[model samples]
Target: MKRILLFSLLLPLSVSSQSNDKMCETLSKINALVKENHFQPKPVDDSLSVFVFDKFIDGLDENRNIFTKSEYEKLSKHRLLIDNYIAKNDCSFMNDFVSIYKKALERKKSVLEKLETVSLDYNSQDSVKFSKDQFPFDLTENDFDRVWKKRLRFDILEDISKLSKNADSLQLHFTEIEKTIKQRVFDTNLCKVNSILNNKNGVKSILKNDFLNAFCYYFDPHSNYFSFDAKSSFLSGLSTSNLSLGIEVSMNERDEIVIEEIVPGGPAARNSKIEVGDVVTKVSNTKGEEYWVSCSSMETIGEMIFSDHNKQIELTLRKKNGTTIAVLLKKKVMKATANAVYSFIAEKDAKVGYIKIPNFYADFDERSPKGCADDVAKEIAKLKKDNISGLVIDLQNNGGGSMAEAIKLAGMFVNAGPISVLVDNNHNQNIINDFFRGEIYDGPIVILMNGYSASASEFFAAALQDYNRAVIVGSTSLGKASMQTIMPLEENNENDFVKLTIEKFYRISGESHQIKGIIPDVFAPVLFDSLIKRENSFKTALPYNAITTSTKYNPLPKNITSEIINLSKTRIDNDLRFKELKSINEEINFTYNKPRNPVRLTFTDVFKEVHDIDSLWEKVKNATEKENSLLIYNTSYDTKKLASDDFQREINTFKLKDIKSNPYLEEAINIINDYKKFKQ
Candidate 1:
């Protein structure tokens, strides 16, 4: 199935003037880059280095990233092999290279086979520990189909190495590699045609999962790729594909799929016939096509779900005690619970109430009139009943939703006016204006943010900060203050792309939020950074830059700006979390950012810093997770209304972490207190 590779397009990027340094300088810079990212180019053989050979291979396939800990550790240990391969200037290393190639392929197939049967025990508290625990899973597959997923990645690199010979042929091989990877999935899923497939909910979920697995493989590890359908479904907390009739699946110690949770209203929930800890053996559709999907088969089960949502699915399930039950189910629509919820916590001045904006979702048609804007308005009305003292807006981990939402939400804090601007790749501008004529939640206001507050989250918080409408608190926002909009393509099988920042956002005051996240006037440390380390951030992200000036509204009192800079650094130094973050940052070496063939002093510095940061980052992560659990339990009280009719009574209490550890909110409360007094 190898089709001719279409290489008429894809011109190589022009080497930048910055990259035009001498060979030695280039080599040194490249060395530092490699070390920072932990890359290696090993020799494939004596005739032709593996690195050179791998060039085509790398281009042909993207990583499936299903390596077990042992596999990854093996790669890490033998990384020099890759370097040797890359170092080979000529194709002298063929025989040995072939051996290495064969061995690597065998290893990848063996590992991938085992992963097919692997499923997580989400209920296990020990699950997250895998990040720290490293490889703990079992890999036990038979021979991989020729040119499987990981094999394709390696093959592409090989193709690249033999460029003169493979330029035309490699592209053909690349196409075949993709086709086989996809076909293997379809083949493997056939193993799942047990009567258990009768569950309509399970079927849809299975199908939706197919899309997720395929979609996710396209982006950088942290970034995600979603199909247009999946994207729409996710934005509104709806995944029609996977609503349970009441069965949740897990794998037993023997690697068998286990059923865990059943929803109350689900068909499985009402039947009392099925019990927890049940294991699934076979699945089928109403038409009775028995699932051929076995642990070793290469078909995709989810694709089956995609076949027909309207059809009933049948599942052949085995109870732990050894009884098998044939259950048939119809799928139903299920709503996704909001990641973050809002409530009116306290009526401070018979007018001020608190609101928390969780992660943002713009909703269908990409229209999110309610994500933050409408939610804020509703929360304000409820909080207004108390003659509220002042309001607090919490934006912790609200990585942002629609830009429209940010502007509309921010307008709720101020009296009126334009809040932000959106510019496209060509730098054309679309200005978003907000004029709030409604009851201003006019009391003393505080906007709460944390390091995870990014994108639209930062935009809204910055507006409040700049306007002096609210005193901002908590850690500095995540520096991802950029924008992107999806663009439809003419022939889209899946090539439709999103255009990201060609232009920038300027505050009403004409200040840019690029690279530099909004700085809070009042500061509180996120406890996670106190324990975890975070150096080398600049390496992983886009360069921070600014755009030329444009007209915008200015809000803050001029003196507040200077006071903020002086005070922020002082607060940061004193904060336990920031102190720890700085300690980690300072230890990073310059060599990670510079060239290192001669091993400059900078490289030495960077290596030292990396070690320090690595150690600290672990400690911080463990500390934050553990600490938040304790803090949440200790501090939050289920707030009840003084009057039964009060909306506050209906509101839920912040879990323990939300209640006790927010020194930032405490600081904001203090700021509000001062603002109230100062105005008098």
Candidate 2:
């Protein structure tokens, strides 16, 4: 019977509409492209079919909130037929899966609406496990009811906790919490329903992408399918003319839209009232039209924000200190600088220069004269003129950019050497060497990196580390050694693009930093290091493998690594701020790794959770204060006195504050100082 079903899958699929034909064509193209171009393409067999099926389902319902166990089983019947369908250009399975998912969403929405109408018993001793892993799929209505009830209770409890914290010991009754939960549920459901109903095209696009991406994942996690709209967005993001409010926003655990970053010189940065961590409660237009944006997804909020440009939008933000403020900001084209190199000098015992390369950004079109390599070279020249004793290159959180720029940047440090080895699909290796003669500043060097430093960033750091030219500091790097190239599938269709993993990068030492990232010689405490995601965390990520390289480089001084490690460890252990951060990280790890167990649904229990979180925040605040106190700005290069405009003043103040609060930078300075001492 299974063979018969597979045979039927090979038959020509019924031509329902133009959309179906287009989807089939796209899928066919993707299959051909992956097989031809992917670094590690899997055979389109039953095994791959199963993998694709599972990936597609998971992509649709990642939290396992919508689909029931029986529904999943129903869809599992076509698992072995996916490969045959793709080969025959049949999208019947894809259509069926999408239909099922849409129905499931509707059913789930109805269930939630019904739940809101019914009163939940808060005094009940029954408790629900909070972890999704505990019950990934529900078997029955009762199980879903239990899950939803528990989730609603938790949400209510969290809100009450926040309220209690603000009210200063004003205990909230169970009735009050229930009332808040009811209102929140209604609001959230309304938004969800409205979003679904209003954005049919968006929903269709997402489903199509999910279906295609599941097949793409058979190659690797990095290989992805970019739809027409997604391709446009991706390209626009890299373009210089991309317009926005200039604030990076994220949806916090509590569904609050929080400002994660205020882009320097952007409208949000210009508006002194707006700050990071500020919760956006409401957004309104100048015409008194208010948008209840709280609890909305980032996409929804973004659409509302980007609906009209050059318009004054009033934002109601709740500050971290629990104060509410409304700020009117006019949307304007952000005048962001293309320069990626930011430098400053440490005025301590010996003047040490610090250069932060956020990313190896470059204009591939060559429209601009300034690239990451050029900017870094300029900064190095400036630091050299200042007669700095040592230099610290900071790549902490640099996710990398242009490979060419990384090569050029690495060349600036080394006169001429092989930066990295690129391995193609056929296992052919190509040595990317820097032929440039003479180093920029061959002084004692230290490179700072964290979990977020990846790709080109890793290449630059690894090159320097391999040559023993720089002492690497901070947590492990992001371990993304694979190189991706975006291949346009259909020339006529702009949206048909495949970002295929075409090659893997290896260090000059013939070491691959694929899953195993570069380890810092002088390790510094990175808050939530374990929680940060890396290439190794992905199940489908490429394995760490190395290739033989014919590159020879100068090695660092013997015992330098051990000496720096010992000195840094001693300082880190003695530092109270570092101790607090370590303690906090330990607590967080414990919380994250702890097994999910049901606890009594009580106000005390909720309060305890809230209290614990609050205590953690308190520790973080104290640690930040201690670290900030130790920050010594380069008074010689103080831009505050030279600032003639509001933009410069705002940016300078932000930069100064950032520098003061940077513990990693301080450690880097110390590491460079240690290098100087050891050399002497």
Best by lDDT: 2
Which tens-of-lDDT digit does each residue in 1-680 have in candidate 1?
A: 12323332222212221222222232233333322322112122332223322322332112323333344344333323433533432212222322333444445555456544543121222211112223332333332332243333332232232222323454456455434543444344332232224434333233323322222222111222233443233223323446444444444434455665554345565465666567766667766566533542212344343244435667667653333567787765444433244654432232335677765556557554446577667666766654557777888757677777777777777666667665554555566666655435777777788776787888887777766676677767776655544332223436323222333566656566655677777555464433222211533334455554454565657354345445544755686655654454444333133332311122122233223334444554444433311111110222333244322222222233344444454445545555555556
Candidate 2 lDDT over 37-118, as tens digits, reads 8787778899988888877787667767778888888888898998788778777666667677777777777777777878
Worst 10 residues of 1 by lDDT: 628-637
Off by over 4 Å in 1: 1-104, 107-238, 241-341, 346-352, 366-369, 436-439, 491-503, 530-543, 547-657
Off by over 4 Å in 2: 1-19, 132-138, 141-150, 166-181, 202-205, 230-244, 249-260, 265-300, 307-334, 556-562, 599-604, 628-646
Question: lDDT value for candidate 1?
Answer: 0.46
Supply the TM-score for candidate 2.
Answer: 0.87
Query: Candidate 2: which pairs clash?
Result: 228-495
Residue 273 miss distance in model 1 (angstroms) = 27
